[model samples]
Target: MSLFTNSNVTCPNCEAVVNMPAVGSVNADRRPDFRDAILDDSFQVTTCPNCHEAFRLAPLFNYLDVGHGQWLAGLPASRVVDWPEVEDDIDSVFQASFGANVPAAARDVADLLTVRVCFGWPAIREKIYLKGVGLDDVTVEMMKMDLMRRLKDAPFVQGTELRVGAVDDQAFQMVWIDAETEDVRQRFSAQRALYDAITAKPEAWAALRDKLSDGPFVDMQKLFLGQGRVAAE
Candidate 1:
């Protein structure tokens, strides 16, 4: 049951033979090794020796529900109680969702993936460090619905998802939020243009762009929520 003890599993990047060390037998606490977290001070990191690929490992394996049907164990963000870089268990959501190339595209701005907004930097720092709202997952219409949902008891935004962008987390942050003004929408759309240019499939790009252009610069949150599930959010 050890995470690092996969007797038959080899390093995906280096093809080096490896084995997962079993943590404990049945009915054990099943806690992960905190060595990496101590080193990370509570964050996780992974690097591929063969490719120099680096990524946060917490989000990737944190979603795994492999222990005794205890789905609740992995629910809250607080469950990430350790920090360790296991190249064997590197975050693969990006690779599986948007393909492996996204790591290169995102490496430059990884720390700034999500930023907390505030009147000042210190306030922003405190809210993010303690409160932990996802900086990269913020969206216009999504923000509106979320605000109205908690503050006003309002309904969710219902519309076609227009343009989507990877502001941070690998989740889709919609653009239909009410607070998004024209300028914000335009900037969001402009970012989409970058993805279109990088795609290997030019035809898909044209088709996507044409479909995206159909409306008069509409909110993309409605158009792209589920469709761009594969796009790095």
Candidate 2:
């Protein structure tokens, strides 16, 4: 049985209505979670290319999302899938379904989380500012604690201490630290929102500098200056 026989997809960015169908391979209901919903849909996945909003399975709204999930940035969004036309031609990774059979390189790609939004120059600049924090050994643990606390309310917040590298290093590496876990989507989403909020109002953000409490705002500066006590102090 299918979960969504007639579902609609709207661009989180353009708000454009997307017309697509969820064609499942196996059973959509038996698949467990929304993320798994698409995997079951051997033939269809809904996405908003304009904003990069993707619902691997139809009834994407049914996906286990906390709030303002991964696609909030709202641009350059799409979930590309590999479908096998021939029975024997199937890719082992997609066949495995649980990502257990993924090779080393592809496995690494799985750990990554992406966000896309068009905030224009100001938003972009704010993100750039946060990225300025250096991931030196001294503040690494603090960064971990900070990520943990901030994400405390966010269940399934990837339990790993994120590796936050320098700006140039961000492309292929996150330098801070690594605390891995299965739950992180929610925390990651929150971080992105916080980033957007701070970026939109830098002066107001600066005034609340003391409130960051390990959000990595002033902490980034501390990481840069080698000050270990607190980000504000």
> Number of the top candidate by lDDT?
2
What's the lDDT for all of these models?
0.29, 0.32
lDDT of 1: 0.29
List model 2 lDDT by residue over 1-233, tens digit each: 33445556665557877766643222323443533322233224456866766643321121111121221121111110111111122223233532557587644443431122211121222232233342222223234444556544433222222433223422322322212111223223223333344456657544334433332122223233223443345
Q: Can you give the lDDT of residue 15 in candidate 1?
A: 65
Q: State, as a TM-score between 0 and 1, how close model 1 is to the true structure.
A: 0.20
Candidate 1, residues 1-233, lDDT tens digits: the string is 22432233345556654433322121113443332231222333345455554432222122111222211111112221121111112234323422446575544333322211121111111222222233222223233333333433222343212223333433333232222111123212223323323354556445544543332121223243433323348
Q: What is the TM-score of each candidate against the true structure?
A: 0.20, 0.20
